[model samples]
Target: MRENTRIDWHARVEQALARVFASLDEPLAWQTLAGELHASPWHFHRCFRQLTGETVKQCLRRLRLERAAFQAAHGEARITDIALEAGFETLEAFLKAFRRAHGISPGGVRKLGAWAGTIAAPSNLHYAPGEPRKHFFIADKGDAHMDVKITTLSPLKLVCYRNFGEYWNLPGTWQKLFELMASQGVAMPAPTGMTVFHDHFDEVPMPDKRSDAAVYVPQDIELVEGLFRYETPGGLYAVKPHFGSCEEIGTTWDKWREEWLPTSGWQLDKTRPSLEWYQGHFDFAPPELHVTLLCDAVCRA
Candidate 1:
């Protein structure tokens, strides 16, 4: 195969994997996926393991368990139904796997309404042809200077563009959103734009990070393709202004989670997502950027 074609295979496999996640109700067969990729089953399996660092069986099992765990915690579905949906033929078999992975029963998780162990959904793995792979962001050692304040915010309704993948790749999503907004005659110098994070990227794998590039808009704006309204929950939040490049903001979040929250006598409100408020037009290429990181907090201690 040509080098470019070989590289393209990685993307093709990633899309196929995403399809598997999206259609968990459908039958999952290696032969079916291999035929779709136009490769023999043995070659497809080898390529998948090389690109994703996990075997096909391992990935499917993890994805199923993670989905089941999420449904148990958030949905009003029966445990047996969830088990069957996750491809388990029997509730006993599902329970055994769930307990082994999470150290708690599905019923126990539902009762607590929270995950008891590290159960994360599989992320889409992308491999560049020749570029060196970059590791996930990590904070520099030491206390980052942060202007932390406690503030209350009213609910905000926004028109948002959603993206799933690495946090660092979010600028592309924003770029697409800007083009859509410009086409609609929306001005560039609007108030600060916001990005709401549904998952903590540092804790979650890169493939699983979910974020929204959003701007506050009136309730009556006409919705277009790829743009939907998101209503943010209003409550008390610990806000901190971060000044630097988008690449460095992860360090700021690490500081807040590790250095500040522990001493502030406040606990994180797990139900709501954290927000990133961008001041002015965010130039993704520039080394300096200004954003405010918002964390939902309550004085529970």
Candidate 2:
């Protein structure tokens, strides 16, 4: 049974990869993925990363670059056109990535005959890829989702209003907490307010949307509300920054859980809570969200 399960899992990983390729333009949502393998999104993310040695998002980025390189080498399209076609919002960003990936400009590739005839495929990028990540997070299957990171954090106390009664009322719950915290001199950093879901969907029937978040503060400070004191333990966490709205943050986790973690030579230890630091002054508008997925080292029993 174990061997059979392994074989099935490998086949599913391939299918997931195929899906990623097929749905490049319009990314599929996590909820929609359940029918693909009869596994929850949480478990599927774990299994896919464990088997394929890369996460879905990491694979997507590579796919985009691969397409860009191919277009540069063969397509009649201009560099800007090729970059836009590959989902890069601007030519500058595309060129920056292209140079890093292939060690030459897209225009330079045409200047050299050597790049011709050779498939413009990406060389395997290991778990700790040479690529730059502004903001990102990785939480794999185990108790804690962190795999690797570099950070300097101080101990903190969080005063949170619990949402134990229902699951979906997360946005409102967060708003209420923020209001209370603001009244108590706890203001959130502007742009995107972060949400970290600790429990998987399967484990908890109605998952809270306002799951948990770190108080955005520049320096160590303490302020408490009545019965809402939550402590944020201080330590180092593997931090991956993403510059996008809150809605797009899941892709960061997908990349880490599926790609970075398995290959990272690190394990998940969820004893410590992860963090999210929003940039700018506190506001409701969707802003860039910086997420930190936390996991601690453990000695096996």
Candidate 3:
């Protein structure tokens, strides 16, 4: 069962969150925390972000603000004291940031009562005087929604442009890649567009997530600036053909992991990358419907 792995992840994150809550005023001890969790810094960062849907920095800041709000609304502490405790060095800086975060000055939180300390967070985590959450973030929402096919793949020679940032902004990158292709006079034997995710979707924040927009090209294809030619080693993959808006593709992949992988008699090959093949018109408009084959590398379970 996947229970052991999931339990271990939850336990590790619970420990880290507790440590973070203990020192809201200080920067999180990333290396030490990673050590305690028995994970590399990169892996821990990704795991935390994936579990909370917010980076550690973002989580710490929001949690501290929640505490400040609680103090303002219910406690008799002075506003300056609350602000300082919340990690702001000065009252003015605190007020500006506080207003920006909660849509009002610290003073306004006093009128909110029960709602005062709550803020919109992806994980629904808040600052409360209680034990940490066992289930930090929503997982396993994916069902048998995508039609997944298990198959073997051949090697691929690709010329790709890597981009980093919000995946939602990938259409813009696709457009830029096309322009680069035209400017370099790249010919059209490029039948399909490929995207290779160097990091897991949850491994890094959207800004740091590395995605390569690639097209199949010759092994000896001449490379230009911002474009590199490389061979993608292929193997067993679980693929799903997603039709419609590119924005909805994430759900497909999520279900592929949550619903399919556990039951499929295969496991993800972490050494390889998550890959995708788009076999349709390159409208460069993410909102426009398109067909995509989402491929995840796998090995025998």
Candidate 4:
């Protein structure tokens, strides 16, 4: 089952790569790619990220930069044209991304032909002119099963408010979300509070890291600007109960990703943001008594 699932995703990803290569010069949305590939946007993004260890955005940016490097090496086009054809909205953005990724500017590449093709990649994938190459990973599935559970999550209509800055420093955000809900006279089905991480913590810039504090409400509840509605798609998720000091939550997550996930018969579903689902009023609960259900999106192997 694991092999078959990976094979299916491998083929689908190759199709996506071909599409991306053909349209390098065009502005493409990750969602659009999912549509063209006949997949749900979330599922497609998740599969691509899991398989390549790169977000769809990251892969696109890398490919554009690689293409730019190729053009510069040939000395066949101006940097402006190269940037535009690479689908970068601005040359400054292109230059910044290129310099950061390759440790050299396009000009530098053209001058010395030092296109760093060895940009670190788990799948070892890079730019190819016509169609990209096939890439997949094979790992032995270990038999160690921890006390984690696989469960189905129903679709959710969430009223969320965005919070930026340090992810862990969000007591005020949750406070605001609940207060706004009260001001709007919204009554939730339960007193559940959820925090959804919109970006990977380590990969995203600290200043731009984003999360949403949300509460589940029925569809009939009206939404205000302070609280917006987001629908979480129904799917399989791996649920692990967390107890004790919230400060140590990071350690638990590390163990899951580094120790359990790689060997589990499930792969991360990238389409959904990781969630911390809280049951009791955390603001009032003692640190030792606080309980959180750490939910990670998952697909069967």
TM-score of each: 0.48, 0.39, 0.49, 0.48
Clash-forming residue pairs, model 4: 46-270
lDDT of 1 by residue, 222-270 (tens): 6679998888897888887775445345645765678877877788776
CA lDDT of 62 in candidate 1? Answer: 70
Kindly indicate the candidate among 3 and 4 with the higher TM-score: 3
The number of the candidate with the highest TM-score is 3
Ranking by TM-score: 3, 1, 4, 2
Select the stronger candidate by lDDT from 2 and 3.
Answer: 3
| lDDT, candidate 4, at 163 | 91
Displacement of the residue 97 alpha carbon in candidate 3, Å: 23
> What lDDT does each candidate get?
0.67, 0.52, 0.72, 0.72
List model 3 lDDT by residue over 81-128, tens digit each.
Answer: 988888888999999988766655667657544443456554556677
lDDT of 4 by residue, 72-154 (tens): 88667999989888777799988897776665678766765533333434454567555536453422232254567989988
lDDT of 2 by residue, 175-292 (tens): 6767766775655542334444444233445533235643544444445543244566666555655444332344454555566656565544466545554555434432333233
Instruction: Give model 3's TM-score versus the native structure.
Output: 0.49
lDDT (Cα, 0-100) at 265 in candidate 3 = 84
In TM-score terms, candidate 1 sits at: 0.48
